[model samples]
Target: MQQLQILSGSWEQFAQDAKLIREQVFIQEQQIAAEDEWDSEDAVSLHFIAYDQGQAIATARLLENNSIGRVAVLKEYRGQGVGRVLMQSIIQLAQQQGRSFVKLSSQVHALPFYASLGFIAEGEEYLDCGIPHMDMRLCF
Candidate 1:
């Protein structure tokens, strides 16, 4: 068995693992600047890490206002359900916290994927950190 694990906690606790995945997917691979990739929000957000066979393969974060962001899955793991699992975990956590909605700014190319997960696109597409993105929301 691959023994996939989905762990959630403070950024401080899993910074190492989360950083590895995020830096690879966002910073290095996607050309996002290092400073833009690491932000102060991490200190306040809840982080989720997906590990496959003990190797970190995906990560995401949910903020206090139910804003979900920083979702990144290593290239090799895309389309394998890792991103879906991470989003579902975040949604379940928000519902457990009595939140009525969850929002995220998704990269333009990823809009369909988020939409498939029930998130609706709102407002016009705009640039964020040099990447075209759109604001999306899901209501519980």
Candidate 2:
């Protein structure tokens, strides 16, 4: 419930905070393998971080091809609009860049949440790092 500040920057700039959030949410909580959690794309992706009480509580990234990924929020902060805020920030950034569409592979459990933001689910569900997910897209 602390004041939330959302920031957009290069992965290099927010690497420590971003990685900490992802490590806690995806690796520690979700049991995702450390090897799968870290990736080479961070060097090139546009990153966003949500800070509450000066702590990085959530993080997401936008790829050059208009795909959003690595959306992670700390466990205690889930269901508090942090994820929506992060997604909206990415969507706004996409709009600013004149992107025609944005896409993501959303975990099945979070499908409804993404749907509420106007992202339509597509294709059959598949596993990503042992988690069921489906491709979702929102077209401008």
Candidate 3:
């Protein structure tokens, strides 16, 4: 595996790289519709992209509301701790910004992953883009 580097910036700075990762993970692998995956929030949200040897492999975004979303890791990179590191960076950024907490809509299957990071499940599972998800929050 190549050395992993995560870069955070505006949509314009990271859009191309972020979209490529999201397209592979969410659009092709998960079969999520393009319409459902892309959103207006992207333009205003802070984006994080994980790159390996300069190739984008994972992505996530932190919205102005202190909500995290659009987390995606390529199939080849799953279970490699890339996602965890990416999320940790986002959480730290939230703390640096003086946020009380950060919330996310975690896919049901990934609940344990987020839980291991200190996120607590908040409500009953619901379908988002046809996938089971539940709200989770991590307080600083």
Q: Judging by TM-score, tell me the better candidate of 1 and 2.
A: 2
Regions of model 1 farther than 4 Å from truth? 1-3
| Per-residue lDDT of model 2, residues 55-96, tens digit only | 889999998988899999998899899988889988988999
lDDT of 1 by residue, 1-140 (tens): 26568899998888998899888899888899998888899999999998898888999999987899999999999988889888988899889989999999999999999999999999999999889999999999
Tell me the spans in candidate 3 whose CA falls farther than 4 Å from its real position.
Answer: none
The clash count of every prediction, one per candidate, is: 0, 0, 0
Question: How far does residue 138 in candidate 2 sit from its true spot (Å)?
Answer: 0.5
Please write out the lDDT profile of model 3 over residues 9-87, one tens digit for every residue. Answer: 9999999998998899899988999999999999999999998898889999999999999999999899899999999
Q: Which model, 1 or 3, shows the larger lDDT?
A: 3
Against the correct fold, how does model 1 do in TM-score? 0.96
Candidate 3 residue pairs in clash (backbone atoms < 3 Å)? none
**Top model by lDDT, which number?**
3
Better of 1 and 3 by TM-score: 3
